[model samples]
Target: MESTAIGLWGVPLAILAGAIRVSTPFIFVSLGETITERSGRINLGLEGTLVFGAMTAYAVAVMTGSPWLGVLAAMATGAVFGTIHGWICKWPKVNDIAIGIAMMQFGLGLAFFLGKAFIKPAAPHLPSIPFGAWSSYPQIQAALNINVLFIIGAVLAVLLWWAFRNTRMGLILRVVGDSTDAARAIGINPDRIRLLATAVGGSLAAVGGAYLSLYYPGSWNEGISSGQGLMAVALVIFARWNPIGCFLAALLFGGAGALGPALQSVGVSEGYYLFYAAPYVMTLVIMIITSSPTRSLSGAPGALSITK
Candidate 1:
């Protein structure tokens, strides 16, 4: 009876903890997509990249006994995938959307085929900092146990925001995104710029994947991503392409995601399954509220194919 009473209080703490944990992947993926779209291109195949990165991270960790090394390996493979997508989309006749779909399918199939061997092995999980050590309550301690990647993602958001507004590279990227003709007139190679941007984006998305397989779920599973990669595209739109905005939006999505499990923990089992739809419903509502058939989204890159 006493534990049940504690459980009631634990519900909010659990949700708070879950929000931070779940939001980490969203932060990385959405920020990555932001970079890609900011370069006047989009790669819808990050879903595949996320899945494959999970598989690769798990496999490498199992082999090398170092989770950090696995993350580096995932980034390398993800960049390669992004490079391929960028190269194909640069062709005049190819469609970026279509090519992105193809790449996604290829990544999924490849990951599945290669991931079978690593499923049974136990790899080292990423370490976390006990921010809750100052608390006497277990729930508080648990809620405060922060992951390193979450901190990294937060710092990255601020850095990207600053870089976008103040750096020379940011100027070039903005010029390319706003107008290819403008970029060319300025003697900038838009294609090369976009390719690099996409590569960097893919690498960041893979870090999100690494977080999944090496930390949260801590396994190499084909189903780990749960469509987070695809939904992040919507997240980017919701964020208005701002890195800091992406971080906040990711936390909102993560809170929605945590709703189901949080309620379950507190004995609110009735209709708990419905809560799983919270994030999707939130996404739909955000899309409806933000989208207008008459005009491109405010802050969208002028040269972006999606906006056109």
Candidate 2:
């Protein structure tokens, strides 16, 4: 009876907490993916970039004793990776998707080889605001804790959405993404614009990895990410490529990803594992709902390869 009473209050709180914790990575990665896709390219190798980012962040933190620097290192390295991908895909007849896959494998191999020594080192974690301070229950307080990165992501989403609508740079990017001929007619370099966009996207994705290794689950390990990188591709689709939509979608995914654990916390252990499927299920449902036979995804870049 007491456990049930506790769960009545606890489950919702746990899920909320889970949503924040799990959503941070999704937001960063999906936002990154959104930026790249908006420029008419898709980066499947983000999984590799993500893993490599986590490894790089962890290793740098261990060496420098500063988590922020670790994140910066990850961002810089991710940019290099993205730059490589962008440069390679600019060539005639080169496939971006294939290059992404190769990059993913290469990154994974490199991270594993380089990250071996740092597995046991303890790195400092990012600071979090105690939004749960008013709650008397320890569990409740813990659940309400919010991190700084989440704040940055939320603000970033709104900024990107606004930029896409109002900025000249955003206009140029859209033009390039929608039509290379249009870009050429306007004397804009399509390849150069894509290269810059890809670099920014790679840096954003690396920030997600830094959050994973330096914060929640807070460790340097091979199994740290549960395909958040690839899943963000679907997430980008679900968000209709809108930055704000990406943020909301990320929170939804976070809540879903946290559902199983939240249920377990409420003593609903049996069948709780099924709830772990929530994010993937949501992804499928969204995809089905969004699919169309006659047109590309409503907001998708015209030049993007994966059209409906």
Candidate 3:
């Protein structure tokens, strides 16, 4: 009876740890998407960028035996992908969303083509901070191996939140996103701002991909990313374009993701595969709840087509 009670208590605690673990990628990806969407551009090709980033990071780490170099390589690749999306979108009559989808296909193809040789290679893993070193339990230690990207992502979110409100550059970005005419009146180039924003967003999203390959799953393959990239798009909407909200929402998603495994551990094994859909289900539910068919949701940039 005592063991049964202890198991029940442990379930929630395990879920919390799982939330922290699973949320890291969402946090990074959603934050990256937030920046792009804030600039009135959307990169649906982030899925491709993410997978390619994972491939690049893993390949570089394996070749150089340094995980940090892998991260740099991933960032560079992501930037290139973003630049491509931006460059193409600058053409008249080109749809940014469609271009994004195309980029996704391009990214995936490139990743698979280049990553064919890296399928069997072993790579150095990212270093984790020992937050649970004081604990004697193995589960505690496992949880403590929290990735550095998680901390960096948290700090980045706070910095971005502050920048959006208090920085000159951020103001310009807002102007561009809200209205191209307004940006032109202020001597700002809307195209340039959006281009830069998309590039940065791509770079950040790649970092999330790097985290997945070099840390969590700690491997590389065509399948490294499931629907994480697409799900991040939905997360950006649920967060209402708030970086802080992105963090919290990602944690909730992570917890939802962990539900199946956590439940399995306690002898509840039915519907295991279905648990994977919990995050998506939650995202859809939130979108329905917050959506306004008649009026745009609050804080949405006026120039964004997604809100329309």
Best by lDDT: 1
| Lowest lDDT 10-residue stretch of candidate 1 | 1-10
Candidate 3, which segments miss by more than 4 Å at Cα?
1-6
Which runs in model 1 stand beyond 4 Å of their true positions? 1-8
Residue-level lDDT tens digits of model 1 in 109-174? 999999999888999999999999997777788889999999999999999999999999998989
Give the better candidate number (1 or 3) by lDDT: 1
Candidate 2 all-Cα RMSD: 1.8
Clashing pairs in 1: none
Residue 260's lDDT within candidate 1 is 94
Better of 2 and 3 by lDDT: 2
Report the number of the highest-TM-score candidate. 1
lDDT of 3 at 189: 88
Residue 158 shift from truth in candidate 1, angstroms: 0.3
Cα lDDT of candidate 2 equals 0.89
Per-residue lDDT of candidate 3, residues 1-308 (tens digit): 53355556567867877888788888888888888889888889999999999999999999999999999999999999998898889778889889989999999999999999999988999988989899666566665668898899889999999999899988988888888799899799888888898899999999989999999888898888888888888888888899999998888999999888888877887887688789889878977877777887788888886765
